[model samples]
Target: MKKMLYFFLLILVALGLAAGVGMWKVHRLADSPLLIRDETIFTLKPGTGRLALGEQLYNEKIINRPRVFQWLLKIEPGLSHFKAGTYRLTPDMSVRAMMTLLASGKEAQFPLRLVEGMRVSDWLEQLRAAPYIKHTLKDDSYRTLASALGLTGPEQVEGWFYPDTWLYTANTTDVALMKRAHQRMVKAVDAVWKDRMDNLPYKDQQQLVTMASIIEKETAVAGERDLVSSVFINRLRIGMRLQTDPTVIYGMGEHYRGNITRKDLETPTPYNTYVIDGLPPGAIAIPSPASLDAAAHPAKSNWLYFVADGKGGHTFSTNLNDHNKAVRSYIQVLKDKDAQ
Candidate 1:
């Protein structure tokens, strides 16, 4: 009986020792961080089983062993509740920490800046090169957004979206980003529209925006914006055509190539202020806040015409004959400079 009891005690000691060793190994494995070299993108497919996820991690070398990951999920089933989305995984993450991140489904984001005055085609090209953008902008999406914004006719989504830098995760949808950009623009327009000066010639905020957009395309010199605004306002008050060069350029369309030609001015298009009697059908480009402000409250001036001097500044004229002389002088100066 004594020998049997001793043997039983020895067996119990060995079993406890084995159990302790196993536990120690598991604890070490759990604490160890998996070393990864390159950046990896992990995607959790819809309804992917826990075992499959474990296997994927093992194959990608994100985890040392599949069984350990599987065991973790089995013990804590709640860890399998990770949402389906794209995640940027670092190689330096520990098995336990990685699992926790996967369950949270939070991903790193890259920011892209959309500057004002960019065309829709330019915007689309930018989004295509962006990381994790996944989907392309459909034709219908632009139409849908335009319709919602109360814009009609053949303009499409050209100048409607407001330009701003936005943060987006790799898993962000294209539609979501576009919608966000539109919302930002709408808010900006509304804020500026509310602060506009009363008794302006424009029928509403939209018309003001349209005029501001034209001024934005004409020049980037902030000091000259109010002056330019005055020129347009003066023309409007006198029932004269705007005759802005940017409008002619817009009318030329693909034929514009780069520089505006005399023929472009003579040609007639809806946007060609050289031929049209009033404001263009729509905005030529996206305007900045300062341009919008200048449009809202123009500097009270009688200037009706402006010609760019060889210098960065422009020479303003109060009458047509003065404008003609200034143009001639500017041309002569440019020629003399070129000859020299």
Candidate 2:
């Protein structure tokens, strides 16, 4: 009876040792590196079971051992609780690390940049071309999209969306993204309008946005924005026509190629600042917040005209004669460059 008891005790010890080895092997497999050389994007779909995930990873060549991955999932409680979403995988990532990332629900985000000074049509094209965005707009018309967004005016959607790098995940709708951008723009406009400088020429918030858009298109230089705003504000104060060329280009619509002619400037359109007495009917492009602020508080200058200098900036003038001289100088600079 004592011998039988000793044999049973020895068997128990061997079984215990085997169990420890099995646990160590499973843990090592869990920490094994994934089979990849470069950064990769891994998408785990919803309703995918753990067993299926292991098999999928094996089939995609992201993992070498499907059985071990399945075993790891079964052994580790955290690995079994991963959610469905897109995840970025690096070559240095271990299988355990990948599982932890999915469990954390940190999905990859993509960026859509709505650049400043671009028209609504350009923004629409940008939206349609962006990957992983769900397109829901029935038609990309100004009036239709405006109605969809609950806006009630002709071309009301123009310049309503803010220009920024909007981040979104997979399957995010385009209209949803646009709504977020519009909300941000509304907040920015309201803030600028509330604290606007007193006695300005703007009749309403819309006019302010219109002026801001013009300011955005007038110059890309940071120092020139407020100065450009001053020129337009002074023009509006003196009942002078805001003969800006950007407005004329916007008025030309699809007819504008790479250049503008004197006839094009002479033609009358609602957006033609050369012909229109005051501000245009609506915004020409989406304006940056800096441009909006510049429009609200123009620089304290008597400047009435501006012409582009050769060095990516504008030369401001307070009189038509000085503006003509600046234009002549700009032309001479161009001629010199051509001669060179």
Candidate 3:
């Protein structure tokens, strides 16, 4: 009887120890702090199984241990949940909380900013530089990609994309971004072109975009957009050459050395407004929405000439004499600044 009692006591003690270990594991999984001290993006890629994921989380220090999680994933009825996404995880969260968050599927996002008046090449460089975005353009050829975008104006891809802050996931590709920006531009143009001023000289919406791009490159001041648009409009209405420097520079292409040479203006390129009678063959740069709106509805003004004022704005003139005087004054201002 003594030996039996001793054996019974041993069994009871062993059972109690096992139960205690189980409770400790449950408590740790339920309330313990995560190994990561702050919020981080934990990407669970596609085809990541539960056991493999647990091991990865453990290796990444996202969790203190993976045994409890692995066991729960195997045994818990109606709790088998996992997803593939870039998850924003925090250290204050428990294992159960993390599991809940993963199940929720509210993935993290990234941002791409396309600024107005930027060159397409510069924009592509930015897309290539972003590490998070997937690169789909293996050829790195803008012309081929532009053709794929189904662009209409100029039969080229220079000023086709809308400028805005676009947010997306890590899976977003360069081609996808290009498609979205181009679509946005198309939508904006279609919406604004419907209510355009009557009897406009532009042949179609593409010509309007071309004009807007010129206006965008002309002025950095938002308030001056309409006035600048009017100057271009008046010039076009009277059969005068644009002679805008930006277009000449764009025509120079790789040869442009920060300034337009006399030969560059004299040599003919389709983009050279001086050489071309009307709007350039296509947009010189990407235009903003305000500029596009200004192109559709230019302010009522007969003023055809403008010269840069001493300030960061332009002085508009209707007559040749006044424009020459303004140009002289601008040159003098520059000389005075240089003499100083």
Candidate 4:
């Protein structure tokens, strides 16, 4: 009976050793990399319980087994408080690292690429259209929008907002987005003003904003802004009309179709650069930082004219003779292309 008791004790000891080894293997696996090689955008929805989340992790191939994760969650204290938000997750992350990331509550951000050179109306349309944004702009009118945003002094809402691919959280509001963009523009303009070149045609920062808007509309090419800015500055200095077609289009408001007309150019409005002696009463579009800088510190050039080169860019000239030659070449290029 003593020998039988010793045999049973040996069996129990062997079983205990086997169980310990098995548990050690499970712990190692919990710290190991997952099967997938790439990172992905993962969303942990609100009200997700541990079981559901473990299953989700398994389904996404983020973990080897849902049961193992579920078992771990049952033992982990204070880690049950997982955050609910979009996350950029990698399968290579260990189970422990994943849990820590989820628990920390830092969500991945999305971008709203408000392009450079869009008008206030275009910016407004984008603001209202974002699914993630909660819009509070009560009306589309300039007066209504200005009042709602607490913007003082200007009835017009043209170039106050900065253009950028603004990063945002899920709960970002449209009004908040606009306000931030406006503040950025203000800061940028002020910074540029302090470092402005000697004897710029702008009487104030707003005029510089107006000039920058013109420069933004004139060119999207990186190298062309300085030349275009110089031309406008020279024109402004010599009491020459800007004669830019964008001003005419802006003046037309909603009446502007796909194309401009001679009558449209002839018809005078506050934004018609051809009729207006200097910068318009306000900006026509949201200008970029580079364009703003270019306007504030125009290139030292005698260039007074530029025209579209019938390609993606413009042909700049220091004199009317060269400008007319460029214009004729541009027209001929268009005619030749049409014939082909």
Candidate 5:
């Protein structure tokens, strides 16, 4: 009976050693790098289970040891609770690292770059074209989109949404992204308006945004923004008609066919600064932060006019005579270019 007891003890010892070695191998496999040459995107759908994940990884050749992966998950059940989303897997990532990333629920972020000075319609086209964004807006109309974004009291939705590179996860709704941009715009406008230089002609934040939008459309030059802002502010202070070409173009809308004619400029629209007094009804396009700052704190000058210098900037003048001279020079430059 003593000898029988010893034999059973020996069998139990062998089984314990075997189990320890198996567990060690499973851990080693988890630490090993995945079989990939480049970055791979792993999309795990909703309701995906650990067993299915292991099998798919093996089938896709991302992991060589499906059995070991399964063993690791079984041993550590916490690794099995990965969320459903698209994960970016790199060649240098180990099985354990990948599992940790999946479990952490850090999905890959896609960028949608919305440029400043573009109309809302232009941005809508980009939003619709961007991949992985869920289209939930009832229609592409400005009123519909504005209502969906919970925008109130704005007659027009042209410049309500801020323009920036917005990052989002897969299946994020369009309205959700737009809301983030709009909220950012609200905060930016409020911050700038609060600290704005006193005695500015702006009656409210809406008029401030309108001036900023005009500044954005007037100049792309970083140095020229404050100067452009001064011109419009001076005009507003003196009660002079803005007569800006961009406002005329915006007023024409789809009727504007590339270039504006004399008749088009004479035609009155709500946004036509030539016909409107003080400020326009609303913002014409999304304004950049720099433009907003320029509008809030214009350069201390008596400048009332600016015409594009044949170069990629504008020449500012305090009088209509100098402005007309600058405009003539600009016309001459265009004529020279045409002649060339």
Candidate 6:
């Protein structure tokens, strides 16, 4: 009986040693390099099962053996804590590290770069097509975003959201992202407002913004902004009509299919600077910081007229006669070149 009891104890000890060795092997496998070097992007859709995920990883060469990975999970039990989402896994990361990464559920962020001078409609189209962002703007997303941003009276949120690159998680809400963009614009406007030229003809910062929007639309060349601002400022100072073509186009409303016609300029509307004799009521489009600066600190010049020289730039003139002469010269030059 003593010998039998001693034999039973020895078997129990041997089994315990075997279990310990098995667990150690599993731990080493979990932390091995095989799980680290796979360069595949794993998108774990909602309701993906752990067993399926393990098998997929094995098939993708992320793991050498699916059975071993599954056995490790059963042994640890904590490996099932891994959550679902998009994960970019490196080829060389250990299985343990990958498990930890997924379990934490942290995702990589993609940047959304909203450039200055983009209209709201333009941005909306871009957002709809963005790969990292998931949104369906079929309903009141725009209106909801505008209202959340405290923008008033505009059916569309154009010219309101400030342009800047923003980083967001993959699952970020559209409204939240838009609100952040709008807040950035508001902060930018506030920061620049106090530094604006004092005692300008405009009543408030809003008017300055309105004028800046016009300047933004006029030209994209960096050096020409101040010159263009001077033309508009001179017109404002002398009480002459702005006579800007863009304002006319804006006034022509949604039916403006293409190009401004002579009749369109003559057709009076509130936004038609040729007839309105002052700044327009609101911004036509969002302006860049350079345009805002140009509007704030206009060049000290008597230039009141400008015309496109057809060389991707404009020629400036100080008076109507000079402007007409420049216009004729530009036209004649183009014609002469064309004739050659």
Using all chains and alpha carbons, the TM-scores for the candidates as numbered come to 0.80, 0.93, 0.89, 0.81, 0.88, 0.78
Instruction: Give the runs in model 6 whose Cα sits over 4 Å from its true position.
Output: 1-41, 45-52, 55-64, 71-84, 90-97, 103-105, 132-145, 333-340
Top candidate by TM-score? 2
lDDT of 2: 0.90
Best by lDDT: 2
Arrange candidates, best lDDT first.
2, 5, 3, 4, 6, 1
Per-residue alpha-carbon lDDT of model 2 for 1-340, expressed as tens digits?
Answer: 9999999999999999988887777788778888999988889999999888988899888988787677788788877899999888998998899999989999889999999999888998999999888999987888767876788864678788899999998888988898898889999999999999999988888999999999999898998899999999998888999999999999999999979899998999999988889999999999999999999999999999899898799898987899999999999999999999
Model 4: number of backbone collisions:
0
Cα-lDDT of candidate 5 = 0.89
Q: Which candidate would rank higher by lDDT, 1 or 3?
A: 3
Q: List lDDT for all candidates, in order.
A: 0.77, 0.90, 0.85, 0.84, 0.89, 0.79
Candidate 1 wrong stretches, greater than 4 Å: 1-22, 74-78, 128-131, 134-156, 169-173, 307-340
Residue-level lDDT of model 6, residues 1-340, one tens digit each, is: 9999999999999999998887787888897976444475677777768789887887777787777787788887777788878776786778888888888898766678877766676777677766667663454454755665566756436566777778877767666788787777677777777787765678876777788889988998899998999899888888998998888877786869989878888888989998798898877777788888888888888899999887889999988898999899899889988999
Question: Taking the tens digit of each residue's C-alpha lDDT, what string does model 1 give over 123-145?
Answer: 76688778888564454344654
Worst 10 residues of 6 by lDDT: 136-145
| Deviating ranges (above 4 Å) for candidate 3 | 1-21, 37-39, 72-79, 91-94, 152-156, 336-340
Look at candidate 4 and give me any clashing residue pairs. Answer: none
The residue-by-residue lDDT of candidate 3 on 121-181, one tens digit each, is 7788899887578887765566667766665432567777899988888778988998999
Candidate 5 wrong stretches, greater than 4 Å: 1-28, 153-156, 335-340
The per-residue C-alpha lDDT of model 2 at residue 209 equals 93
Relative to the true structure, candidate 1 reaches a TM of: 0.80
Candidate 3: residue 288 lDDT (0-100): 97
Query: Which is better, 2 or 4, measured by TM-score?
Result: 2
